[model samples]
Target: MNASDRTPADLLRSALAADPARPLVTFYDDATGERVELSVATFANWVAKTANLLQGDLAAAPGDRLALLLPAHWQSAVWLLAASSVGVTVEVGGDPADADLVVSGPDTLEAARACSGERVALALRPLGGRFPQPPAGFADYAVEVPGQGDRFAPYAPVDPDAPALAVGGLELTGVQLVGRARADAAELGLAPGSRLLSGRAYDSWDGLSAGLFAPLVAGGSVVLCRNLGELSQEGLDKRVESERVTNTAV
Candidate 1:
């Protein structure tokens, strides 16, 4: 298929086949002094496992809306791709009450409990650890995802024209999402193999585009930083130098 006809999942698959050993995402939590890097193969493995969990265990379907109540962490990125792989619509920071499934971070547990659908809670801890115990009304993602198959196949083929993402009162189909991401990557001067360091939060289009989708569309990699306020100008510069960052979106 041509690039314009490809979905985000297709982009990921291409990246996996083209350069499995290259870093696709490098995440940093400045507040907690944590850093994690995932190669294309590693990230795709996580996506596969999570996709299996969503499709098999959670019974997710193409039109189902998955409320993603998480921040700009690497795991959140994984969930985005997993939902795309199964043609499940991702509602970032959306109201859980209307969702078919809810995936929440530690801080949003109370709000997520209001959703009646299946719930998954993420610790967002270092190494993507599980909660010490399962939350009252939710399954622990880290625990369940590990037992899932390392490879995933959707029950049915994903439609590129299907609604895929909803954020900031805007929704886009899978094809539209990929098209916009490709344009944004070009506008931002992201070439293949570029390393982008981004400190934008994922709640808005600019952040999501810069920190995740653009890099994926451009065949580049992202160094997504959370709690960026904790970094001084010097520290930030040092990170850019150390990480070989070719672009910055702060």
Candidate 2:
């Protein structure tokens, strides 16, 4: 991570300053045969729009709790950074009823309705498509997010020392989260411009670090694969080669 970076949003800004045109995330869903790549600028644009949706539409404030009930897809990555930018605490796979707001994927929409607060749903379709019918009691993320502003400025500044993530029974401040991400990036042998291929779920700290934060802090990109077990060795090898992956955390 950059020495000047405090929050995850700061890290993203540092990366954007470094190279906005370079690919920051390459996502593939073996089960659906889908592939998508986003440069730093493109990824940050999505983050900005999503952050606007969270802060403006959902009326989320700093310290608000967000239950993220999504998988390790590109949209999930967008939501993570967006929540961080909004200064909202994110709880991965958290209980809906305990959250001030819940963001869920198609598979978890029914369960996400337990949240009495605001709810957002992602269809997880290719190219970030919307659901045919909006789920009841939940805003369609793909639909609402696009209409949001391209740029975002948090009404309230995020506190680096404030809680930013709650996962695996552990709570971490933004500073601590960045510290851990830097450490994980080192342990995973990531370097500037490195591409790390990860085929892990986003339910645990390890998976989260590998799939998202580590690469972010390392000034590298991620090849995030979902349902990777379904891919043949030949296919996986081809993907690794095509994505120019230098490290693996599958």
Best by TM-score: 2
State the RMSD for candidate 2. 0.7
lDDT of 2 at 148: 94
Model 1: clashing residue pairs?
none
Model 1 clash count equals: 0
Q: List, residue by residue over 1-250, the lDDT tens digit for candidate 2.
A: 4798988899899999999999998999989999999999999999999999999999999999999999999999999999999999999999999999999999988889899999999999999999999998989988898899999999988999999999889899999999999999999999999999999999988999999999999999999999999999998899888788899999
lDDT for each residue of candidate 1 in 143-191, tens digit (9 for 90 to 100): 9999999999999999999999999998999889988898889888999
Q: Candidate 2 lDDT (Cα, whole model)?
A: 0.93
Model 1 worst lDDT run, 10 consecutive residues: 1-10
